[model samples]
Target: MFNYTMKDNCLAKKVILVTGAGSGIGRQAALTYAKLGATVILLGKTVQKLEQVYDEIIANGGAEPAIVPLDLKGATQQNYIDMSSTIAQQFGHLDGALLNASMLGELTPYTHIHQQIWDDTIKVNVTAQHLLSQALIPTMLKADNASLVFTSSGVGSKGRAYWGAYSVSKFATEGLMQVIADEYDESNLRVNAINPGATATAMRATAYPAEDQSTLATPEDIMPLYVYLMSDDSQNTTGQVIKAQ
Candidate 1:
């Protein structure tokens, strides 16, 4: 149960993009953003899941959301360019993006990690994010206010055994957030990273099978921070990592 009071229309008329919006935290964030008055752009690899989220948002009387089914593992610079162009044409400008899509490659020792797994993890969690941000920054700059939120994990700060490429990828995510935040310090656009600690997500279950699911915080429980960072409330906040539990 998140106790933060979200003002109605806090995000009124804003255009926000959320990656990995098919399920988990991304899904919850997208729905919440819409409820607060943003026209959300749902981006994920699974069309079916995206559609399900789409229906939920519409059924709740939230803003009409657009869907973009994109596999980050295979997404190229051109793919991102096209997405940016479409967003600019359709929405005029993007006010925010929740860069929540990530791949948790197998949890194995560094020596046991497969080359393919490492490459794919980096491609999805790092390369695609970089390209997408590069393409979307221009769109964000067009807006009067903008925010870019990157997802991070505990392993990102201190490498853990058997975390492998996932941990390394999150480290890269942190670095990307800091660099972009610093560059945008003088601009209206703000960048920050969030570590959704011990959430009950499919990815978390896969990473910690022995843990009790009921003990973990649900995705909805983390929406307060997500909403705050994306909304104008955090306009002066940037280049920092916050924990959501």
Candidate 2:
């Protein structure tokens, strides 16, 4: 088990937003943030899953959360802009945003990569994130302090065979994090990337079906990095890729 000392007061009065909050790392992070005293905004395509997470947070006596049903794959810039505006109107300001929604297009030979799959993956995993961040930065700037975390992967830093569009998208995410971090270097906002190593999740299972599941850590196990990145404890840290295991 992980040792978590972040109390209900750690993120008191903070307003945080998490994409992909329907499941896996994003869901755990959302719950953890709520437990730490942050009012979380859960954004995902599936409203039912987000509702379950929201109910869990409230039932546990943590903060109540807001849910926004959005599919990153089909979301437009206007949609992201509207979301940012709505969040600003409701929360006054946003203190954190976790760009965790991503797609694994396919693991196939480079020559066999379908153009449609490649395009869709890049849009969901890269372009959508970029647009969302672009729209939200203004809202976040209104806060006293802000944090942005991008979900990255091992293949992002080191190219591996058959990783295809997923790898390319992650690499783009890392670069996006770096650029944003640099732009906000003098501001109260900090941006960083976290590589959740070989976690036991649906995404992991799909990517490596033959791997021994017992050997891998659960999504719950690597939350320390997620919490640290979101907390004031790591306020000065930015533009770095971190491994969570």
Candidate 3:
């Protein structure tokens, strides 16, 4: 540990937006950020679930949070732009954005890839991330330093049989992070990706029900990496794939 005493709140004055904030890694990231003293923006598809995170943050005496219910698979460019505009108007700048929302298409043979599923997976896992970042870059640039963290997968770096669209989408995510990192190399923004390995999340459960959940790390257990990426301590790092295992 970095040994800052954690303070129950260390992210003072930072404003972060976490996608898929309703559950799993996204929800845990939101809570971690808030508990560290950040004003977090919760973006997810389910209102009730987001409200749950919101309530938890407030109950913990952390900074209050905001909720944005959005479905990335179906989100339009205009919607993201409007969201960006709204965020700018309210917070003026964004210190960080965690692109954690994703869709896991049905596992199938590459030859049997369903067209609709492929498209939806790409939309949610790739296009939506780009659009959301596009909408927020201006706001992010306003900050003295800003971080953009993309959620990636192990299959993204190396192809795996039966992973289908999910793997392809994650590869695109890794590529996207590098592109942003290069583009903002001279700017105040930094971009990177994280691969949370074998996490005890619902997604993991769906993908590997036969595995022992007790053997894996919970979302909270992996938060140190998330916190490091979102905080000033990581201002010097970018364009790399960091693992939380």
Candidate 4:
């Protein structure tokens, strides 16, 4: 696991956005950020799940959270722009953004990968991320130090059999992260990617149903890297693919 001791209220007064904030790693990260004193914006397709996280944050004595219901597959560039505008209007600046939403298309052989699955996977994991980053960069730069963290995978840099569009999309994600990081180098906004390794999440279960959940790390177990990247501890770090295990 990545080692970083987070102090209480490390993220005080910060405004962060988390995609896929409804469940699994995203949900845990949102709660953790809020607990550390950041106001989180939960963006996900499911409103009910967002509300549940919102309630949990409020009940835990964290800052009040905002929710943005969005399905990345069908979301347009304009949607992201408008959302960024709203964030600028409401919060004046964005301290961080965790682009964690991803779609795992069927694990079929390369030749057997369905067209629809490929399209949807790329749309959500690649295109949506591109648009969102473009829109959020301006708002993020408004802060003194802003971190843009993109979720990656073990296979993002190393290709594996049967991973299909999910793998390809992750490769694109890594590329996107590198591009943004290089562009914003020495600037207020820093960009990086994190590969959350073999966590016991619903997505992990879907990818490997027969795997023993008891042996895997929980979402909370891998949060040190998440908190480190978002907090001022890693203000000088950028353009790296960090593994959380």
Candidate 5:
């Protein structure tokens, strides 16, 4: 696991956005950020799930979280722009954004991948992220310090045979992170990527159903790195792909 001792209320007064915030790593990150004194915006497709996370945050005495029920597969650039505008208006600025929403298209051979699955994966994992980042960058720049963290995978840097579109999308994700980091290298905004290696999530279970999930790390286990990247402690770090394992 990535080692970093987080101080209580490390993210005080910060406004953070978390996609896929309804479950898995996103949910844990949202809860953790709220607990650390940041107001979290939970963006996910399922309304009920988002409500559950929102209730949990409030019940745990964390900040009151806002929910945005959105399906990335069908979202447009305008939708992201409007979301950014809303955030700017509501919070004045965004301190951090964790682009954790992604789709695992069928893990089939390269040649056997379905067209629709490939399209959906790329749209959700790559295009939507690109658009969202573009819209969020300006809002993030308004803060004293901002972190933009993109989720990568073990197969992002090195492609695997059966990973197919999911792997390709992650590669694009890393590239996007680098591009943004370089563009804002001298600014208050920092950009980076995190590859959560083999965590025990629904996606992981779907990818490796037969594996003993008990042996894999839980979403909470990999959060030190997640919190580090979002916190001001990593203000000088950018354009890097860090592994949380």
Candidate 6:
């Protein structure tokens, strides 16, 4: 786990949106951000999962969180624009966003992958993220400082034999982060990516079903970096890909 401690109210008054806040790292990030004092906006495809996270935030005495059940696989640019309008009306501006939702499409040889699976994976993991970011840039600009964090995988930086579209999408994620980071280098809006290595999440389990999940790190164990990256403590950091273990 990363060595960092969050102070009480470190994120007080911030309004952060988290995609895929329904489960795994996204869920943990939403809860953790709320606990640290940010009003969280939970976005995921499943209403039930988003509601669970919302309830947990309330039960834990964290900041109240809002839920937006959106299927990233099918969401359009207009959908993101509408969401941005809603956030603008409700919160005035957004302080940060964690782009954590992703689809691990069938891990198979490139030639064996189906077109539909490839399209769905790319649509959710790559296209949706770009659309969401494009729509939220104006909202993020309203804040003196804002952080945009993209979730990445180990396979993103290297070529693997059977990772398929999932790996390709992550590589695109890294590129997206870099491009945004470079474009905003002179501004207070920072963009970065994090690779949550070997975590015991549903996605991880799906990717490595035969592995013993008990030995992997939990979402909570790797949250310090999430908190750090979003806090004012890391406003100066951007473009770099940080690994959380």
**Residue by residue across 1-245, what tens digits does model 2's lDDT show?**
14645555688899999999999889998998898899999999999999999999999898789999999988899999999999999989999999998999899999999999999999999999999999999999999889999999999999999999999999999999999999999999999999998988888889999999889998778887888888888899999999886
What are the per-residue Cα lDDT tens digits for candidate 5 across 1-245? Answer: 36688789999999999999999999999999999999999999999999999999999999898899999999999999999999999999999999999999899988899999999999999999999999999999999999999999999999988999999999999999999999999999999999999999999999999999999999999999989998889999999999998
Per-residue accuracy of model 4 over 1-245 as CA lDDT, tens digit each: 46688789999999999999999999999999999999999999999999999999999999889999999999999999999999999999999999999998889999999999999999999999999999999999999999999999998989999998999999999999999999999799999999999999999999999999999999999999999999998999999999997
Of the two candidates 4 and 5, the one with more favorable lDDT, higher being better, is 4
lDDT at residue 114 of model 3 (Cα atoms): 92
TM per candidate comes to 0.98, 0.97, 0.97, 0.99, 0.99, 0.98
Local distance difference test scores for all models = 0.94, 0.92, 0.91, 0.96, 0.95, 0.93
Measured with C-alpha atoms, the lDDT of residue 177 in candidate 2 is: 97
**Regions of model 2 farther than 4 Å from truth:** 1-4
Model 4 error, position 150 (Å): 0.2
Displacement of the residue 70 alpha carbon in candidate 1, Å? 0.3
**Backbone clash count for every predicted candidate, in the order shown:** 0, 0, 2, 0, 0, 0
> After TM-score superposition, what is the CA distance of residue 63 in candidate 2 from its true location, in Å?
1.4
lDDT of 6 by residue, 47-146 (tens): 9999999999999998789889899988889999999989999999999999999999998988999999999999999999999999999999989899
- Return the TM-score for candidate 1, rounded to 2 decimals: 0.98
Which pairs clash inside model 5?
none
The whole-model C-alpha lDDT of candidate 4 against the native structure comes to: 0.96
Which stretches of model 4 miss by more than 4 angstroms? none
Which runs in model 3 stand beyond 4 Å of their true positions? Answer: 1-8
